[model samples]
Target: MENFFDQYRDEVQPALKSKLEEFILFGYDSVTEEELWQYLCKKKWKREREAKLLYQIVNDILSVKIGEYMNFATVEAFKSPDWFGNQGKDELSKLL
Candidate 1:
């Protein structure tokens, strides 16, 4: 059976590649793609402010404090798919 990361790569990674690339650039050639994927799984960056979220990971690697904010548009795009999927749905409707 495929592991979580394996499944994630096959499913989510293709769609998320560009955003993941943006995160990888901060690693300065030292961070491997696998490492970034592991980190994403560990940190849940997709569920929240991913740019700011990415900054936290990058900052740890670089030993610098930066990337304090992300604009609304980026935040909207970065939220977890589960969160976005519920945006137009009503809880009461689901309950009925």
Candidate 2:
């Protein structure tokens, strides 16, 4: 299922790039094209990838909002284990 969208990535690269630029312009400096693509694959189009047409996927990318993408990114960050593991106990305590 992971490679389901790889075939269309090249076809959709332009739309993805445009969407990424829009995110950056809106002050989402940390957002990358890959992350955006991941959000689309893992969230937005997760259940409908096979049924969706190329144009629809492009529309989804172009129409996604900053808030939506940021929310997805924040959740993804929280899911990563590196955040607390990289910090020592004292550093973690300081953060808390």
Candidate 3:
């Protein structure tokens, strides 16, 4: 059982690290490895749910960091015309 958990964590760490990089890119300066681990655990390690949870965390952080400037009602504002898409938007756009 112990090995199973260890191996599982090892398998997931790469994905978690990638997600953590995205969080850091969002200007979430306070996020730590432990916090990312907690977020993964909170999602029970489900991929889709974990992605949604990460998005929520990023949005929540943005809500605090950008305040009233964070909300956008337009759908086009959420999308990108180029191949990069919304995922390619930088931290500055998140603030805008």
Candidate 4:
């Protein structure tokens, strides 16, 4: 599924840029085009079973809200093994 979407990277560049700009305007300065693309590929479009029209992809990118992206990012962060690098289970539990 991801391989199928990889072909649309260039075509969707503009929409990704537009969405990144929107995020920046809302004070999410750390957001990047690559991260936005990842969110779409991994979260927003993860369950897609068929090719989407270019316009549909563009709309999906442009329509993403900061909250949605943030939630996705937060979940991804928690999923990363490095998020708690070197921490013992007890230490992690204490932090939580």
Clash counts per candidate, in order, are 0, 0, 0, 0
The TM-score obtained by model 2 is: 0.81
Q: Clashes in model 2: which pairs? A: none
Candidate 1, residue 91: how far the Cα is off, in Å: 62
**TM-score of every model versus the real structure:** 0.31, 0.81, 0.36, 0.82
| RMSD of candidate 1 to true structure, Å | 14.3
Better of 1 and 3 by TM-score: 3
lDDT of 1 by residue, 9-46 (tens): 55444434554455457763443456545455544443
**How many Å off is the CA of 47 in candidate 1?**
11
List candidate 2 segments past 4 Å from native: 85-96
The best-first sequence of candidates by TM-score reads: 4, 2, 3, 1
Off by over 4 Å in 1: 1-6, 23-27, 45-96
The prediction achieving the highest lDDT against the true structure is 4
Local distance difference test values of all predictions, in order: 0.44, 0.84, 0.45, 0.86
All candidates in order of lDDT, best leading:
4, 2, 3, 1
Residue 52 lDDT, candidate 3, scale 0-100: 39
- Stretches of model 3 off by over 4 angstroms after superposition: 1-7, 43-96
lDDT of 4 by residue, 1-96 (tens): 456788999988988888888888889989988888889889888899988999998899889989999999999898887765565766988988
**Predicted candidate 2 versus true structure: per-residue lDDT over 2-90, tens digit per residue:** 55777889999999999888878888778888888899889887777356688987999899999998898899999987775745766
